[model samples]
Target: MGLPARRPHAPAEGRARGQGGRVMAPFPKIHDLYVSRMVVMTVLLTWTVLVGLDVVNAMISEFGDVGKGNYGLLDAVTYIVYTIPRRAYTMFPTVAVIGALMALGQLAASSELTALRALGLSRRRLSLSVAAPLLVLTALMMVNGETLGPWGQRSADGMKTAAKSKDMAVAQFSGLWAREGDIFLNAQNGQEHADGKDTWLELDDVRLFEFADDGRLESIARVATAEHRKSGWLLRGVKRTYFEGNSVTQTEVMEEHWTSQLDAAALAASASNLWRPRYMSARDLRDGINYRKRNGLDASEFEEHYWGRWFYPLNVLALCLAAIPFAFGTLRSGGAGKRLFIGIVFALGFWLLQMQFVKLAGVYRFDYRIAYLMPPVVMLGVSAWLFRRRSG
Candidate 1:
């Protein structure tokens, strides 16, 4: 009585028995690594295409300015090159969502997603796997925004300024010219300083030229250092020369209160690249917020950008998740071009929605953080509802 034949061990779970009784290979593991690679490759491809178009448009616009001052074609090209990092940083969120949608769309088109689902991988699980790579990319983009993006923007700005002006030169270590009424101001150099939790801008070798109504130079004041204080601008080590009929009278003072309508914010923005809240890092934004608050100035705009920066990752991921549902159902049978069109429309709609929320916040004077948060929160809710419906 021979031993009963084992039932071929039930094909060992994922293993399949062929006609010749040879066990076939198990289905390839579709873990985070495999999904992440697909998503990342698609994202890179999409980013390249989108960024290339954007750069070309920018080059065309920049080329129009080539003949202005000493700004030749080479200068225009150089300026565009310097700004690419910032452009990449700015476009990444849009690129990420579109890329993710295209990736999943391809998978669904190939029926790989159906296979994954049949193998016990839920849509939620696949969504997470896709998000993992984007999370890493978000972190990398944050760093790029802080470092290369701002640096490149500043360099581009400086290069353009230098090429466009002979007497007025702008650089990190150089100076910029600003005017208020008949008075022209120049700061030989400026630097941002941080003292504990407080931050401020200090200008060195400050010069102010006050012109008379008749176009005659009334007086020239020179200061060693100029600082913006809550009270007003404070000029230290001041020397003033009055030019009346070619007989100059010089007066020296240890300190003087500068009176002018020149905006401190504008000065900071022009003097240092770090002061532009739009391009500033989280740390710089925080410092700017603190400084504005301490000075009793309006900090709403800074707060808006600060909260926006912090919520960037959440917003991007939520949008991507919301976009994923489009790849399933009817879209599964659709062409890749159709999916891409849908992704673009979705991204544009989301951007418009976000802009509306921001505008509403400004109109109603609500907490800017709430404004920044609502879009992502709405996206996440929508995603969850769609996923639940699909799963059901």
Candidate 2:
């Protein structure tokens, strides 16, 4: 079906014309916005399906102690909305790039662009008309990434925990590690033992130490199983091995538990939320980046994540730029299908390379700039060059 008409402009670009040899024609701006919006919406719908599949897949993987069915349909709707924006943001640029080109190329093929050009609408004006709305869109996407994306993630994660409570397995003790003032806990298993975002481990051989507070072993508690109740935790079959100045005290009991002050949801979110950078925004990515840096941990993954976020909107623009040359490059021949296939291959390859490089960056401690900047930089620069060559 044909695209719907362009909505009115946001007033800024709705001004009177004649900036250069020409200002953008109202129809061109209107047409481009209409098409770009359609492109974006199409991309978003596709994202919703794919992301929905992914969400289901993830929940399926954690098919442990399924404890949810608590949240209402509103829960699912909110989660669906939450999941889309960041993903949509990531994909929007590519959509705009490819979609804009496809739309324009279609227009050109049908002689719409040619007619407009003949009517004194230069290619420059046309590009400006198209890009101006896109810039605004990019900004809106960034905002969604910041506000809604993470909030949705937390809420959705909570629901998942409730659903997966049956499989709510706790981790067995995997020793202890500390950074800053807080120590990170790991168990043989971490799926259960808590509600919300936190992971409460049923430590097998618990080992803990705190340096900042007193440089002394504050308190060590080990138990057979730490069951997470709503307010706090209930540890069954407990033992406490305490250290005092070189003296050690041992206490054993049938049952014990600790109520932690930290937000369980946030902690659980951190542990389980690993590997899903698509849910994180640019700012969230930066926080993740900084976390790795402060821990003296290899941060290339987070660094790459940060770069991906920072360069993401630009990537969209780049993809659009890339499509321009390709659309025109293969234009002499006539098959939109081929261009699309090639674009898919290109997008996939680039994403795979990004994942591989980020891992390699972690392994080698490569410079953040080198790891993050190179791909988008190189791809975008090449795309720009190609577009110039085509237009020239």
Cα lDDT tens digits for candidate 1, 278-320 = 8766776787678667756566767878888888888789889
TM-score of each predicted structure versus truth:
0.73, 0.58
Tens digit of per-residue lDDT, candidate 2, span 94-191: 55555555555565566666665555544555566556656677888878777776666655654544443422222212222212234333332122
Can you list the residue pairs that collide in candidate 1? Answer: none
Query: Which model scores highest in lDDT?
Result: 1
lDDT of 1: 0.79
Following a full C-alpha superposition, what root-mean-square deviation does model 2 have from the true structure?
A: 12.2
Which window of 10 residues has the lowest lDDT sum in candidate 2? 169-178
